[model samples]
Target: SNRFSYSMNLKGASMTIDTACSSSLVCTHVSKLHLRYKDNEIMPASVVNGLNLMLFPGPFVGCCAAGMLSHEGRCFTFNSTADGYARGELCGALLFKAKQFNPADGGLCCLAGSQTNQDGRSASLTAPNGPAQEKCIAAVLKEVGLTPTEVDCIECHGTGTSLGDP
Candidate 1:
């Protein structure tokens, strides 16, 4: 079973942040909020993703499992003989300015808004809870005054495991 993976460096706009699965996405949200604040003026339309890998399994196991390896010399995206996603490691850098640079200095990436929720239930210890998931997402939509229909994308943590889907 594959267990580890790696990626190279990436670019950023104003500041580089690191979170777990929500890191890259959170950074993007914050950037938008900064733009709304009108502290800076630079905000790129598109952003780039950084290298991120996930490894380690013990307390629990989901539907997804894999690994990473360095064979001869080249780097691999997803090898053929690989099993599942070893460990999930992801890094993302975005282009954005701050809401306030130096008090007198203006032109920062004003944050428009952001939303966050949680999966309250943790089945055994590392399992995902559905009710909690629904509540969190619902809260975000309510805060934004939008409906689920307005959501265009969903970056999920399915893990390709039976538990994740079934």
Candidate 2:
């Protein structure tokens, strides 16, 4: 209710989506489509934000989870050793609009698309399949006509589990 009135100004030109961990990423993908294919009709400037709060104490009983919070103590981003300390946080935010702002306004940091899928068999609500991981990578490559060798680094999901690592 806090931001609904503000959202009304966005109208049919805007959208609100919730995809848990991948929420912001999903928004970026859509914005890219709008920019590349629908720019003539839609001015593609957009603002994206995410927030994570680690409040469920019961979920980590007897677990030694470790993670770092943002300098302001608000998020746990890309920290290598991040554990259950990972919450639905202010994960990130982006301000972008197709053709609305020129790159020189501020250096243009290029945006790329991502593909996300479920493993289906969440055997323990955490376990993920290696084949699924491998396939997801392959699917992205096929869509973009690129190979793994061309990519530099990968931001991994460090849920403090070896199984989840793969």
Best-fitting candidate, measured by lDDT? Answer: 2
Number of clashing residue pairs, candidate 2: 12
**What digit string (tens of lDDT, one per residue) describes model 1 on residues 1-166?**
0111113332224454566446666666765655555434344243434565545554124322222222322333234432223344455455444434343544334333456555544665445687777877776677668787877666555433333433
**lDDT of candidate 1 at residue 92, scale 0 to 100:** 48
Candidate 1, superposed: residue stretches over 4 Å from native: 1-18, 41-49, 53-114, 150-153
How far residue 166's Cα lies from its native spot in candidate 1, in Å, is: 2.1
Lowest-sum lDDT 10-residue window in model 2 = 66-75
TM-score of each: 0.45, 0.61
Model 2 lDDT tens row, 1-166: 1274276464324666676556666777766666667644556465555555557865344343322222233333344433333334355666666654457878466654466677786575556677887888788778778888988766555443334432
Q: Cα miss at 33, model 2 (Å)?
A: 3.8
The Cα error of candidate 1 at residue 40, in Å, is 3.5
